[model samples]
Target: MDQDLNVVRGDSPDWRPPNKLLGQYLLSRLKLHGDRIIQAYPQYNETVTAAVVAERAVRYAATLQSLGVGCGDRVVVCCGIHPHYSSLLLGTICCGAACATLNNKFDSGDLRRLMEIIQPKVVFSMSDAVPQLQPALSQLATIPKLIVLDDEDTWKWFINNKIAYHEPQGIDPYTNVAAIMCSSGTSGLPKAVQITQANLFTSLMAFKHKDAYVQADDIVVITSPLFWVTALLYSLASMDHGVLLVLEFGASEEHVLGVIQQQKATVLFTASNFALSIAKQPSLNSYDFSRLRIVIATGTAMAMDTQILVENFFGASVVQLYGMTEILIATGMTRKGQRILGSVGLLVPTMKLKIVDPNTGISQGCGKVGELLFKGPQVSPGYLNNPEATAATFDAEGWVHSGDIGYADSDGNIFVTGRIKDIMKYRGHHVSPIELESILLSHPEVLEAAVIGVPHPTDVEHPRAYVVLKPGASVTADSLAELVASQVAEHKWLHGGVCFVNSLPKSPTGKIIRSELRYLTES
Candidate 1:
C-alpha cells in the first residue's frame, strides 16, 4: 500500500442530474431541429429528418403499449442496418420498457444465451436475422413475440397502426432500467449490462454540458452498427446535439471515401481497426477531407503510426476513447484535456477513477501500474440475471474493477497497457501483448498484428505474433520476429515464433480475440 492514494477525480465531478427519462430527453432535443437531417443510410437510400424520429417514437410507444409492453418489461432488437433503428429503440424506452440490442453478426448460440438472460417480451428482428434467431427464440422457456422490422405488413400493423396511448406514469428515471447492452469482453462470453434511464441521460448530458462538443452542422459519419454500445453512445450524443448522422453499413473503402468527400462529414467515429484499414488505402490520401475535424477511435487502442496517419489524412484531432458497456463515459479526449499520444486521455467529467493493486488490495500511486477501478453516475447498475458476475467485478464500495493494467502519468493521462488476464507470463516475467503488438504495428509491412501467449513446455507461456500483412507486402516471418526481439527484453521476445494470417479473429467491436488466437496455436 503506497501512502499516496492514486485516485483521480474529474475537474467537474458528476452531480445529481435532472430526473429525465432517456427517451424523452432524446425526442425533446432531436425534434427541436425539426427539418434538419437526423440520419442518412445509403443501404436504403434513406434520409430521416428529426421530425420523423420524434413522431415515430410517439407512435411506436403507443403500439408497444397496445402489445402489452409496460414499465419494467424488456424488448430485444436484432435489426441490421435499419435506418429507423434509433427511433425503435427510443420508442421502446419511451413506452416504459427497456430494450436490449443484439449484434447481428453473433452466432445463434450467443444470441440464445443473451435471449435467455434478457427474457424479453418482444423482439424487433430484421427480416433476414429472424431465421437465425428463430431457433433460439423457440428454445426459450417463455418465447417472445417476434416482430420483423423490414416486413411492410408487420411494420404497418405493429408500429404505425396504434395511435391512442398515454404516457407512462409514476416512473423513476434513476432506478428504472432503460437499455441493456451486451458487453463484449476480451476473454469470455458477453454479459448483458443493465443501464438505467438516469445512466443514459446523465452520460449524454455530460457530453452535452461538459467536454466533448458537437456542432449542430457536424455530419457525424458512423460506420459501426447501432448494436455496439460505443456506436450507441456516439449516436445518442450526435442526436442530442442535433448533429446530422451519416450511418454506413458494410461500406467499401472507396465508398467510405466517396461518402466523406460527398457528405463533407466533420466527425468520423468508428473502431481503430476499421480506421487503420482505411487509412492504408491509397485512394484515401486523394480525398479532400477538409471538413473532417474529429476522428474518434473506439474498440482497440490505436497504434502511434496508425493514429498519426488518420490525423494527417483527415486533418482531424484523433480522439481515442476508453469506454465500455458498463460505463458510458470513463475516459475520453475532452476540450479541457487534449489526448497524449498512446494514452486514453483524461477521465471525463462524469467519472472518478482509482488505480489499485489487484493482489495486495492497496491503492497505487501515480506512474505505478495497477488494475483500474471506476465509479460514476453513468456506470451501469449490474449485469442482467448475472449476480455472480456483478458481485465479482463491482465491489460493495461501488468501484467497478476494470481488470485493465495501466498507470497514470503526471498530467493524469491514463494509458491502458493490456487487460490483467491478457498479460503473458513467460517464466515468471510479466509481458504485455499490447506492448509487443505496438512494436509489430510500427512495421511498414504489417497491416495489423495480435500477440498471444502460446503454451510452452519449459516456460509458462511464450509470446507469439499473429500478423496480417498489407496487400502485396513481402516481409518474411523471421524479419518481423527479429524486429521485436531487438527492441524488447529477452523475456518479452517472440519465443513462440511468428505466423502471418490473412486476418486475426476479432470481436464485433473490432478488438482482437486473443483467446481465439491461442486456439489457433493449439490447432
Candidate 2:
C-alpha cells in the first residue's frame, strides 16, 4: 500500500454500513435523540428539539401520503431557511421521495429552468418563496402541485387531521436517489446532481472518519445555504450524532459571528470566501472565539498564509475538505506537522483516487499533477436526467472525472492546483491562477484577490489580477506584482497587470464569480 502506486486504494477503520434506507436511519436517529435541542435560528428566534421536528416531519409525510405521493417521485423544495426546512427534508425522505433544492437564492428565471429539468410531482414552497416559484409554475406545461408550507390553515389541518402511517419498507440503498442538488462550480449554468441513498449514507459516515470527526454536544455554526452539502450534513448530524446545529439565513457577517460567540460554537463549516469575509470584519476582534475547535473550509484552494491567519484568529485548526458539490474528494486533520500545510489531506478512506492526464488517458504517478478522478459509493451516481453531462463527467468505469487540476504526493496528500479550464496558457507554459492567487493572498494588505487569463496576441493569454485591499492600506499594484514575481516563475507573473478594486464580485454563497472578473478585463 506504500509503494507510491498512482492508484491508491482507500482504506480506513470500520466503514461497514448498516442495511437500511437513509430515511429509516434518519427516523431511528430522530427517535433515539428525541429530546435533544437540534436547531437554532437567531433571526427567527427559534430553538427546536428533535422531538418537535420529527412530529412535523411525520405530519408532513402523512400529508404527502394522503396526496398519493410515494417512492420514486420528485419533490421540488424551496422552503428557504425556514423553521420547516428540516422537517420538509426529513418528510420527503420519510415518504421515499427525492427533494431537490431551489431555494429563494434562485430567481424566477432560475426556477423556470430548474423546474423544467426537475419536473417534480410536487412543489414545496414557503410564503417567502412563492413570488419566485409561482411565476415559473404558471408557465410550465404540466405544472406540479404547489404546496405552501407556511399556510396556517393547511399546516393546522395537516397537524390535526392525523392519518396514521408508517415509513415505507424495502428501499434499495444503492439505486434509490436521496436528493438532487443544483451545482454550478465556478461559472456556467447549474446542473442537478443526483445523490443516491448509498451515496448520502457513505458521505455521512466518511465525515465520521477518525482523522476528522464530529461528536455529540458539538455546536456547528452553519454558514452555507441549506441547499449546499455542508448545511445538509450539519442538519442531519444534529439528529444522528446528537450535535447542536446553529442555523442562519445566508450572508450577514455580524449575525453569523455573533451566533458563533453566543452559541459558543465549537465547529465551523464554511467556504474560503465567507471565512475571509469573517477575517476582514472590523468587529471580529471584539468577539470571543475561544470555544471554536475546528474550522472546516471547502469550495476552493485555501492559501497557506491565509490558512495560518484564520487558524491563529479562531485558535483552531482549519481542516480543508476538497470536493465539488458532486462529491467529497478528500479530507484529514492536523497533528503538529503531520499534515502538509497546503495539501487537502488524504483521499477519503471510503474512496479510491487516481490522477489522470486529461490529454492522454494515462495515470499519473506520485507528485505528478493531473485531473483527479475518484470512485466510491460516496461518489454521486450521475446528474439526474442530463445524460450528456452525466456521461461526460461520470465514466462507464465509475470514475467521476473531476475537472479540478491537482496532484498527489506519495503520502496520498492531494494538492488542488486549479481547474482545467482555468489554467492560463503563457508562452507555451501552463500557468495556474490558483497558484498565483495563493501567493497574492499571502500579502498582509490584500483583502481579496482573483486571477484570470487576459488575452494576449502572441502568448495565447497572460495572467491578470483583480485585488481588493483592506481599508486604509495603500499597497501599490507594483509591490503586489513583485510579490508574485519573486515567488513564482517569470512567465507566471501578473503580465496583464494588477487592478486594485474596491470589492470582488461573488455568488450568494460567497464563491468568487471569475466570469464577472473576466468581463471586467474585457469591458
**Candidate number with greatest lDDT:** 1
Q: Cα RMSD (Å) per model? A: 2.2, 2.1
Q: Residues 258-324, candidate 2, lDDT per residue (tens digit)?
A: 8888999998888877786677554576887789988878877786777777777677878777876
TM-score of each: 0.94, 0.95
Clashing pairs in 2: none
Q: How do the residues 237-314 of candidate 1 rate in per-residue lDDT, one tens digit apiece?
A: 766877788888577777877888888888888888788777766556787778888888877776566678767767
Which regions of candidate 1 deviate over 4 angstroms? Answer: 1-4, 13-16, 184-187, 335-337
User: How many angstroms is residue 376 displaced in model 1 relative to the true structure, after the best TM-score fit?
Assistant: 0.6
Count backbone overlaps in model 2.
0
